[model samples]
Target: MSPKKRFEFAFPDIGEGLAEGKVLELKVQPGQRVKQGQTLAIVETDKVVADIPSPRDGTLVSFGVKEGEIIEVGRTLAVLELEEPDSGGGEAGMEEERSLVGNLETATSAELPPSREGREAAPAGPPVTAGTTAPGLGQPVAASPVARKLAARQGIDLAAVHGTGPGGRVLRKDIAETAENGRPPAAGRVQPLSTLRRALASNMERSNAIPSAVIHELVPVEELVALRRALNEGRGGEGQVPRLSYLPFFLKFAGLALREYPLLNAAYHPQRQEVEQFGEVNLGVAVDTEEGLAVPVIRRADGLSLPQLQAEVDRLAAAARGRTLRLEELRGGTFTLTNYGAFAGLYARPLILPPQVAILGLGRIHEQPVARGGAWAAVPHLPLSLVFDHRVLDGVYAARFLRRFMDLAARPQELLLL
Candidate 1:
């Protein structure tokens, strides 16, 4: 007979460039039985909200972090009690870090330090969210970490605040609205920036450092509109079909144009002072999520059919909104596209994401009066903005690429054949 030893389980490295995550939730409480692969916590990184799972089956002990606090990788998340009947060594429960979304690279127990109690005595702590070794919400509340932090700062009761976020989760906006009418804390108090905001600040600082330029065009797309209508109709061959958006069409043409001008599909290495040209068209589509901006990559864009592009766009967009996107999905983009038109934006000189040299911004399609063959007519026009890193590409090269893409997009039916 052997006594069960408590082991400290640390958070594993989730992915490259991913360092810290806010503990959005705790799934298990102290003294609760847990199984391998069961979610221990819902951690929100700057990229996504991941369900971090337990590696070995054991009884739950306590957590080292609070719900709203930032925890770095390799930090111990929870302690677990396990009986090592066979090993009979100091290391019993320590194993490779497990995750519900993907497996972390911690393949051996050597990655985690031994329990402070020497894998013998039980861990000391209370069951709750961010004090030292805190207990988690056995059942989590439907509220984001930002909302929780905001409510605490303002001394607003969360149970009364109406949540407008998806699934009725309280968001920061919801908290702000409550403050506008509640008898809470004083106004104009400084608030901590959310994880997403901090990342955005870093990216904006990098973007400001780059010398960029933008070129815009308003091209009539009556033919393109008719072509899209036909494609949507073809989906059902009859009555109302899904509104296939203009983005997939725009992106498809963008890929074809990139094939003609390969330099547009390239990255700038500032430190190395060199340009890396790409033969493949991997479009990074910027999606606005509840957390913030997320750009997921669509690999081999030139090879995928329009329908395939639409499917990929839908999957990635949904993953971004739900905070389920993996780290790899957010990297390796040679070029980027942003459809600001979805939000009624007429046009924008969108900032270029780092390394990638070019970005195309699309505004919403609308009907405007235009002269065709000396006749005035109301026609749909797609607004386009091509922003490029001046160091990697000159205006002439970018303009040529944009013109080629526009020409291809106008002939919507022709794009399908290619």
Candidate 2:
């Protein structure tokens, strides 16, 4: 008589040197038949939430970890009763198991193996709010990932938005209409901070420890505006440049300005008691997302052309807003740029983030009266602010860097030469 065949699926390494993650959702139950490559669960590690797939066709005998439990790599995730008996050739079976082990290590950022039915695999999208629902919370409402993200961003209640999808699932288009039609905002109430918000709070607390000083200036950007207008006219089409913002100009100018003032592109290590300067300019762009603030880095910003920089910025910003940035994209930034101009603020005292000694903020560009040719004329001016570690930089150097930066910004012709 043949023995019962069982296969234990362990939580494989999901890359990023992450050793542990919290199980967000369990799709299958005990005694349920699951096909190979079917999504079994969603796991979140270090802010990266990804869907975990079944390794083989089997009946889910039992779940090793309950939802909301943190699990480490190599820990058994589930025990499955195989649909087919194990072949008598032990060597071939072991080889097949080894291949499955490798497949388990893949992440949303990587090209995943094909699924059994070839469904369009959804990549790691928006973040799911963490922590278990309170007792009697009525079995957590179900919504599509896009719908959840849109609702969160628009601050609309998911329950209030009528779902038109199958089984009353809220669709993205419905959420958009709800946002545009001015749905009633939620009443003010104390609520728990989300996983991403908690992390940001901790980081800001750490950042507050640094002795920082802020300085501001108004950069005349008439030429910059004209240049952008000219470029857009030349394109002659909508969405020719996906996300053509003033950011790429700021990034390019900052990189050039950093070359002249390398001290601004440096970090300070308190324990080492030394300032480390970097030749390569890795710019961290602060992106405001539904999940809180995310700073995705642009490596070697000094080398990328204006168009390339625009593309990279658009890609990272999309990923960040969509909640798909990997761990590496969030770290190793030598300098930071925060563009509050996109929203509302006119000027802000940006804070220094961690080991990085400096942060630059670009505020809204406004038309103001200026003395030109002995006559008052309205011209566009960008509000600029720079915050730096007091221990590493003095006001004099900061003033000098700002002067050079503004000069580059004023002369768009020169900036393009770089």
Candidate 3:
């Protein structure tokens, strides 16, 4: 029998201070072959569902964890057996080769390197005698350019304020808080950003940096509400009675509008200097979680009927709350719609998720007096806020799109036809 080779695969730091995650689904079996970057499993952290990719190309020998199991950082995920054992030698031999490479590179370098004892050695370029300014002394104190400017603006004495950064350098947060509080600087408290918080912050920042604007419209949803009630009561005409919500109606209308104005169902790539108009409309529905907000997408929304849309919405929402949504389910959105009305918010400027060109926000639905057939009557009305990237879509195009949505939402029978 051939000797078994052990290749350990440890969990990597996926750009956030995520200490643990629950395995939602395992994609590979114990003996399956996996390539580098191939998704091995789906892990649900508090914030988002990320695909755990294989870091090495090999055959999976053993899986260290199971589905629905919670794992901590630095834990072994899987073990692999290399097809060729002698390709680069085993793990220990590979480490020795890496060390040899580092030594050779350092030996050939011009600059004096640090000692093997892991302590800073004396500078070898020139000798400094007593009474002469040392190499680092008399030189400007090491601080970030932003920190220096902040200190100058706040009239802060850097010498008095102890730096919490590397080599005792002051950071921006240290200066700002100190200047604002009008108190002596103290040791900085480093709180690592949670996985969800970091993802939320990054998404919000990106949305803010994108050129976006919101256009408001009032859509009378009397018929839409009636349709929803009928559907929920199993009285409506359909293949299967859908778990109804206002979202499917809104999505159907949005999808129809996308067919009319394809620009809204597209993404603007700033680097590529291109606007990609997707042939299919994939709508994202924003769901509020305890940690923050997350938008999971419904791929190919244009192809789904109202009942199908409702089913998908319910499934995705449940998956999101359960933290079982796949990474694929969270991606490939051409546009997004957030229903803040469920929580009783009137209207809000919802941030757009780039490179998607637009997002639709649904505000509180309430009974309001409306002029109908030359007489004032109480009607169910919803406030719609459409935010789109000004770079990719014009105000005129956005207005037209909202008008189409209003028409469909006001008389939902039109959506059945589309």
Q: Which candidate is the best by TM-score?
A: 1
* Best-to-worst ranking by lDDT: 2, 1, 3
Off by over 4 Å in 3: 1-84, 88-191, 235-242, 372-375
True-structure RMSD, every candidate: 8.3, 7.3, 15.8
lDDT of 1 at 131: 37
Poorest lDDT segment (10 consecutive residues) of candidate 3: 110-119
Tell me the deviation in Å of residue 148 in model 2.
4.3
- How well does each candidate superpose onto the true structure, as a TM-score? 0.73, 0.69, 0.61
CA shift of 266, model 2, Å: 2.7
Tens digits of lDDT, candidate 3, 227-337? 888768853456755567778888888888889999999999999889999998999999886546778899888778878898899999987765556555777889999
lDDT tens per residue, model 1, 211-303: 999999988788998877777765744554445778888888998999998887998899999999987889999999766899999999988
Score each candidate by Cα lDDT.
0.75, 0.76, 0.71
Clashes of each: 4, 0, 0
- Highest lDDT: which candidate? 2
